[model samples]
Target: MTPRKGERPPVPEPLPAPVVDAHTHLDACGAKDAADVSTMLDRAESAGVDRVITVADDLASARWAAEASTWDSRVFAAVAIHPTRTAEFTDADKAEIERLAQQPRVVAVGETGLDYYWDYSPPAAQHEAFRWHIDLAKRVGKPLMIHDRDAHADILKVLTEEGAPETVVFHCFSGDLEFAKACVERGFVLSFAGPVTFRNAAPLREAAAFTPADQLLVETDAPFLTPHPFRGRPNEPYCAAYTLRDLAALRGDDVAELASAVSGTADRVFRLRTVTSDLPNGEGLR
Candidate 1:
């Protein structure tokens, strides 16, 4: 959970097609400066990980993600106060996040939701902040990205009660098939991370299989949850190729088809408009 060694994992081979690292902390992934962000994108692109949504966990990060989205064409942003940081979530913080949500490049209004795995923030505060973010997402007309830890039922309850935004994605989804069904029925997208590629991640694999191609997504959650073989090493967007490959094998699906579906879903959900050469003449921004 700390430094993943100065020497990060080598970038794997390119995927059959490009995909999105739906949720990653580029600023926290040894990419603190603008140059670092650009270099990271260059590396990611080489592996067919052409686009990324660098997410922010706190106010400072929210600002950085907003700015970073503008630095490189391939990078977009997701702004939020992570649940652990929700204890300090204030009116001012909410106001700023609301402002950031309106930015063109800030595609999603979260990575915000319930997290009972830690006691850094009390449940009451978490609930209140979660509701605020849900409302914020609705008001701003952006997708809501959730960070659900061990609080599945409560997360679902809050979304149901407050009413969800037009688009909702459970970043680093850790739910079982039943919970997965609940989210899908509500039109929520489940994003599979490196954990889905593990031998012991049968529950997650089941959820992946149950998730329709249209409702399915994948992420690196980079600098953490690196997929198997590279499990505890370190992660980056390029490694999303590994997870995509494994997911295809797990579900008995075609890799190229899966890649196309995931990338297309991300472009649609996040409203990415990367002006990269990867796009044919007047092809994307969907």
Candidate 2:
């Protein structure tokens, strides 16, 4: 069956091996409820994108993502207030997030970080909220997934000053080779999205190239950033396969090899134990 009118991009071919979508927003991607989530996961699984970390950019979505993870064994959640909404981040928001952060299904503490591109909130507020998130991540002992958009320098400074959590991921990394190298030097993971596959994204492609195998990840960030041929259309978790395949092609590595590598990295970073559950629910294949 073809995707409906709102869902413009139909499912593409399955990947050579299974992988994980390290960052995405189920609500933003048009999944209204648990049933919609299952449908989205079905499409993703069909394309060999076996598991996903559905992220939240606000308190309501964070609540939704936390609950959504419980709907399926394959879905996990990351909860946080977005940089663009820092001004709105309040005591109530922090309290709710604190409660949500403790949920077993919630994996990382993020989609948090600075976004200088959009000034929806004052810079001072954004910094304050970022500090709060960093502390929350450390308290919860979960990875911190960052959303750096045109604020790499301040991002580095803030993380350095606050002392980053044990694990940090640069979600939808949109940096040049130098920025990429700087991130890599600090032991941060760079998660590539649809932009890496664009015809003109030579710099993003270059960063994807020299990135360490174990420190790389893939995502759709969809209902947005759809890959290459599917750019300008609605993206879904299934579309991550396109980005992964494109990365494999760019690096001249075997598709299956790259898939396995990223999958393992995602498993550790998100600590989504079900990631390797492809074997069986019980003690089947280790």
Candidate 3:
């Protein structure tokens, strides 16, 4: 069923413990300035999502994401040229992305990888750009977050060919049991989003259940993929709390236990730290 446009999902009850949103898009969610960022994170914090990593899809958003990370201590950023937007990638663009990748507040290089579901960019162009982003992640010593949408095999293939970064994350992971095994075997982090709660996602549930707690993460991918019962509605970082509850129920694990595992994994993988204290008089990132 399609939710009416502009229909926002209700904020869910707080989790038993705090959890980080491994991925979200604050710019797309209508956050224009520090106040907007603060208000958005305040809702998320109230729902037990105390932190988040806002990911960028292109250069403009990448710049915005890096600056947004400074707007609030609860936020971190990941910058990359998404595969679908790589058709016209240029040297200057590459340089800028590399620069952003090195920023202290930018925790990862991603929302990168193949997206065969869309024809917005040709496969060859996407392949070339994906390789470049893979190398950038390695060079910067940061985790690589992937966006595999119907290109799982090629995504794996390229990572193998390019030599993945020390830490890798399959954001909004969309694979089955066997693919999940492949990622787990290689020690790749699989970040589950709202789709695992969908009624038609049994295979996804199987994959989620099979993922070791240490290799697992949860996200909202906000402004999209709102969890079931609230599917088709607008999503935000707070909705990550709802996804966590459903994931725990689906995996038959204790919510607090899973939340702890997820939180620990996020801290370790992203090398996250308390940055709000770094802001001058708590004035936010400059």
Candidate 4:
């Protein structure tokens, strides 16, 4: 059945092998509590997105994201004050993020980098916060997930200047082939999102094709950037299956092979763990 205007695109068929939604925003996707989180993951699981990393964009969301990870084994958390939201970033906020970064279910310190497209936060503040998050990721021994927008040069320069963490992910990577090559050279993982499937994103497609399999990952960045044939409609983690399948077709790779590569890359970069009922809940988080 055809989806009508304003309706979400139907869930795509499951991948031959499960893949991770490398980055998403469950809180923004209307996941208000544990039950909502479970429901969202259930949908994602049905579509072959067996796990997700819910990223935080602000203090409240950061807190919520951390707690939400504890609600489900399939959901991991990445805590940070988004670059655009750093205008009034406080020390207390930094302290809390640091505390949350240590949580067992919190997989990375991320979605933190530059967004030159928006004027919501001053460049100076964003730079300062980016540096701090970089340091935090390094200190916590976790991958640093970046949110680079129109500031590719600055993002690379800053990471170089501050010394990048052991593992760095360009979350929802939006760059041309040149930028992709540069990130590839630095061993930085590029996580493609729904926009890569857009009609106008030829350069993005080229970049995605160019990224090495080991450094390649896929994501939804949910509630935004819904894939082609569904652009402008609301997005959710389940939509990752659509993006992954599209990526396979575009790159001329076998769906199962590419899905396996992406899943392994996510596992390596994020150091993901399968959450079990016996595992401590929200351990080491204050």
**Model 1: per-residue lDDT, tens digit, 79-113?**
98999998878789988999888887789988999
Tens-digit lDDT track for model 2 on 1-286? 7545455576778988899998899999889887899999999999999989999999889999987887778888999999998887779899999899888778899989998889798999999999999999999999999999999899999999999999999999999999999989889999999999998999999999999989999998987899988778888999999999999999998999999999999988887773332223523221
| lDDT of the candidates, in the order given | 0.87, 0.89, 0.92, 0.91
Per-residue lDDT of candidate 3, residues 153-251 (tens digit):
999999999898999999999999999999999999999999999989999999999999999999999989999888888899999998899999988
**lDDT per residue (tens digit) for residues 1-286 in model 4:** 6666678778777889999999999999999998899998998999999999999999899889988887787888999999999999899999999998988778899889999999999999999999999999999998999999899999999999999999999999999999999999999999999999997999999999999999999999999999988998999999999999899999999999999999999988887854333255645322
Alpha-carbon error at 216 in model 2, in Å?
A: 0.3
What's model 2's lDDT at 201?
A: 95
lDDT (Cα) of model 3: 0.92
Candidate 4 residue runs with Cα over 4 Å from true position: 274-286
Deviating ranges (above 4 Å) for candidate 1: 1-6, 274-286
Task: Check candidate 1 and list the clashing pairs.
Answer: none
Would you estimate the TM-scores of all the predictions?
0.93, 0.93, 0.96, 0.95
Ranking by TM-score: 3, 4, 2, 1
Q: What is the lDDT of residue 101 in candidate 3?
A: 88
Tell me the spans in candidate 3 whose CA falls farther than 4 Å from its real position: 1-5, 274-286
Clashes of 2: 0
Which 10 consecutive residues of model 4 have the lowest summed lDDT? 277-286
